[model samples]
Target chain A: MKLYGKFFLINLQSQMQYKVSFFLTIAGQFLASISTFLSLLFIFSRFPEIKGFTLNQVLLCFAVVQMAFSFAECFARGFDRFPSMISNGEFDRVMVRPRSAIFQIMAYKMEFARLGRFFQSLCMLIYAMIACGVFWSLSKLAVLFLMIICGSIIITGLFLVYAGLTFFTVEGLEFMNILTDGGREFGRYPFSVYGKEVLKFLTYVVPLALYQYYPLMYLLGKSDKILYGFLPPIGTLFILPCFAFWRFGLHRYKSTGS
Target chain B: MIEVSNLTKSFRVSTREAGFKNAVRALIKRKYEYIQALSGISFRIADGEMVGYIGPNGAGKSTTIKIMCGILTPDSGECEICGRIPWKERTRHVRDIGVVFGQRSQLWWDVPVIDSFELLRDIYKVEHSAYRKTLDELTQLLNLNRLLKTPTRNLSLGQRMRCEIAASLIHSPKVLFLDEPTIGLDAVSKIAVREFIKERNRNSGTTVILTTHDMQDIEALTERILLIGRGRILLDGNMRELKQRFSRHKKIAVAYAGSLSSDMLSNCDGITVREEKMGRALIVLDSNLLTVSEVIEMLSKTVDIKDISVEGVTAEEMVVELYKAYRI
Candidate 1:
């Protein structure tokens, strides 16, 4: 944790070096994400509800996924550039360190610029809370929080796998982007709206529904089993396989030329 | 302490022909050739001995270092460092060794040099007092007090190189493996780094293994040199011993008044006349077989010797000759 903080501070200082560029990127990110919000709004203008859920409920889903996505991207941007790290001889530097490779990679990069989308998503979450008619309980609130944390971990895990794939094929970047950006775009609506097949794929394959739909159902009073609320935290274990793959990739890294 | 026997590593490298179409075709149907990076190589270094691991490029220098530092595992080999296999016992093995990859740095680029050092101290779990003592010693020896506060990216090549060396030493490992530590540094920084390395090895009894293209580094830092070519140990012996074995040829520049008789070279045990042009004649005399004074006296008795100069084989030329012999 101490090392994480030091890394965070280093990244903060590095970003602050170019204040104008940082703010511009944040604003640009904010604008880019707002289009998704606007599209959801325009769709709801024609249809009063998405399946059984109202605009308010769907907005809440959108906000939760966005929050998780933004937070994960903010922290794990290091993995996003893993290919360049290998090509630029940075991986060799990473391997010699006494610390854990994951933490060091995480500490090496932090995407503060993505905070723009985070702020926009947060505001949507607050408005959805005011607009939605669902009653709030301490257990429900806890589940909501767990959902976001688990969602972040799952997405970060996907990013880790994406990076790990770079070990075998340096140019396989676009293929992994399907999971990262594709998951985020598909995540705008609750997994159920995509029908049973899509939800099953997300549940068993990527575990996107593990954090977004199943646990979320309990939080919104769709299910009575309180255990559902705890499932999101359990979903975080998806990173295990991803981390193992990363280790495997590291073993295969024939470090590039000097 | 280190023990190794019959270490070998091979890599399967994809081969490709030229042209964009060919590259695309390779993507579709690729052929791979196996590269024997290490071919049953074996050697042992007693603790505290500075062994210069020298090799031509692509001769598995980096591969061997990686294996020794626990970054790589050989296909079939036995390596025990400090009573532990490097790759099998990576965490424990790494605790006792420090690696400085010259082209790469262990320091975080955006962080100050001191911050990197402190992080290393924590990562290594060095006791606070011991960390402080080691930091002070390294800073004083490397003259790093001024460079500590600067972000690594802002420092010049020389400044950054000094910090790179310092970053690796913060843990005070028993063995220090330097892969081209003085590469691309200005002459001044090179000497400073050399002095600091020598001092660390002498005062602390830290084992230093340096791999560099600069032969001077071997001459100054290590008495023993291990030459590798084409994934094989071609020569491994003391520097003086290598010199005497390959020191049969020495250049003698002669300025004759007019002409020198061919019979003048006949009296010498083995004299190879390299070039005899104009008033000056250049001949290579076997120094190990005949003393320079004896050759000069013998040459003077037959021809008018205006001025004469004898040159011993430098490490640079000796290395070039060795490479030529190996054809690596």
Candidate 2:
């Protein structure tokens, strides 16, 4: 943990070297997410209810998914940039170190620019809480916290899987974005809005609905079963297989030219 | 201690002609050819031995270093360092070793060299006191005090290289692998690097495996050399032995007032007159068979000698001969 803190500080220092570029990138990221938020607003203004869920409820869902995505984008930037690491032989340096490769790669890069999207999502989340009529209770707060943590884990797992695939293919598989970026886009609305087929796919295959739609339903009083509120922790189990895939990929890792 | 036997590694790389249509065709049906990077290579280095690994490009020098560094696993081999197989027990084995790939920068590019060093200290879990002690020693020995505050990208190649060496040694590893460490450096920087390496090896008894294209690095730093060509060990011997074996011939240039007679070269067995013009003659002689005095004596007896100088074969020529002998 101390090592991680030192890495964080070093990365912060490195990023601070280019003050203008750093602020510009953060502003760019903020505007990028803001555009997505505006698109959401336009859709909500046209039709306030998305499959029986009001605009405010959908905004709450969008805020949660956006927050999770931005957090993963910040902390898990290494996996997102895995292909360039492999191509440039940075991965070899990771292998020679005594530390775990994943830890080193994660520490080597920290996307502070993603904080722009994070704050944007935080604002939307607050506005949603005010606009939506759900009462603020301790249990509801706990479930909401669990939803964000579990959601970050799921997205991070997807990034890991994406990184693992680089070991096999020469180029990064761009179609994987349909699951990652597409997940965030589709997640702006509750899974039910996409119909039952999409909800089942997200639950059993990707497990996005387990932490997002199911517990969200319980929090919104659509369901009274507390079991629904506890499903996010179970959804974190997806990380195991993603890690297993990474280990397998490590074996087949053919390093690039020296 | 490091031991490697029968190590072999092959890579299957896709091959295609360069053209618009060919690239398009490759997308549909790519073909790959297997390249044998290391073929049954074998060697052993005892603790504290500095072995210079020399080879032509694509002759498996970097591949062997990569395998030994635990960055790449071989297809079939037995390699053990400090009683641990490098690839199988990577974390445990790598803790005792440091590797510097010359073409790559291990330090964080945008941060100060000291920041990178501190992060490395934490990653390697060095005690604070030990880290401080080692950093002080390195800073003194490598003259890194001035370069510490500079970002790696801003430092010159020589300066960055010094910090690179320091970064690797911050953990006080038992073994160090340097691939082309002196490449693209000026003479002063090269000498500094070589001196630092020799000092480290002498002081700590740390084993060093160096791969470089600079023959001077081999001649100046390492006593023993391992020559590889075409993925196989071609020669393994000490510097003196290799020198005598491949560089016994010396070139002798004699300037005389008059041209030499043809009979002057007839009786000379080991000496070949390479050039004779304008009262000067250049002769090649095998010094092992015929001494320089003998050649000069043989020449002076026939032609009046004004000035004579003999040149022994250089380390650079010996390397050429070695490469020629191996046909790589």
How much does each candidate deviate at the interface, measured as C-alpha RMSD after superposition? 2.0, 0.9
Positional deviation of B303 in candidate 1, in angstroms? 5.6
Please write out the lDDT profile of model 1 over residues A1-258, one tens digit for every residue: 987886787778878878899899999999999999999889999999887878888888889999999999999989988888888878666666667778878877899999999999999998997787667788788888888888999999999998888888887489777778888887878889989998889888888889988877786778888888888888889999999999898777676644
lDDT of 2 by residue, B164-191 (tens): 9999999999999998898888999999
Output the number of the DockQ-best candidate.
2
In angstroms, the error of model 1 at B144 is 2.3
CA shift at B137, candidate 2, in angstroms?
1.4
**Candidate 2: docking tier:** medium
Angstrom error of the Cα, residue A245, model 1: value is: 2.7
| Residue-wise C-alpha lDDT for candidate 1, range B1-328, written one tens digit per residue | 8777788998877999999999999989999999999997888889998999998889988888888887777889899988999877777888899989888878877778888888788778888999999889888888889999998889999889899888888888999999999999999999999999998899888999999999888888998988888888888899998887778888899998756776668555678777887878888887667778887887787778988888878888889988898887
Which residue ranges in model 2 land beyond 4 Å of their true spot? B254-257, B260-269, B272-282, B287-290, B301-307
lDDT of each: 0.85, 0.90
Specify the poorest-scoring 10-residue window by lDDT in model 2 chain B: B258-267
**Evaluated with TM-score, which candidate comes out highest?**
2
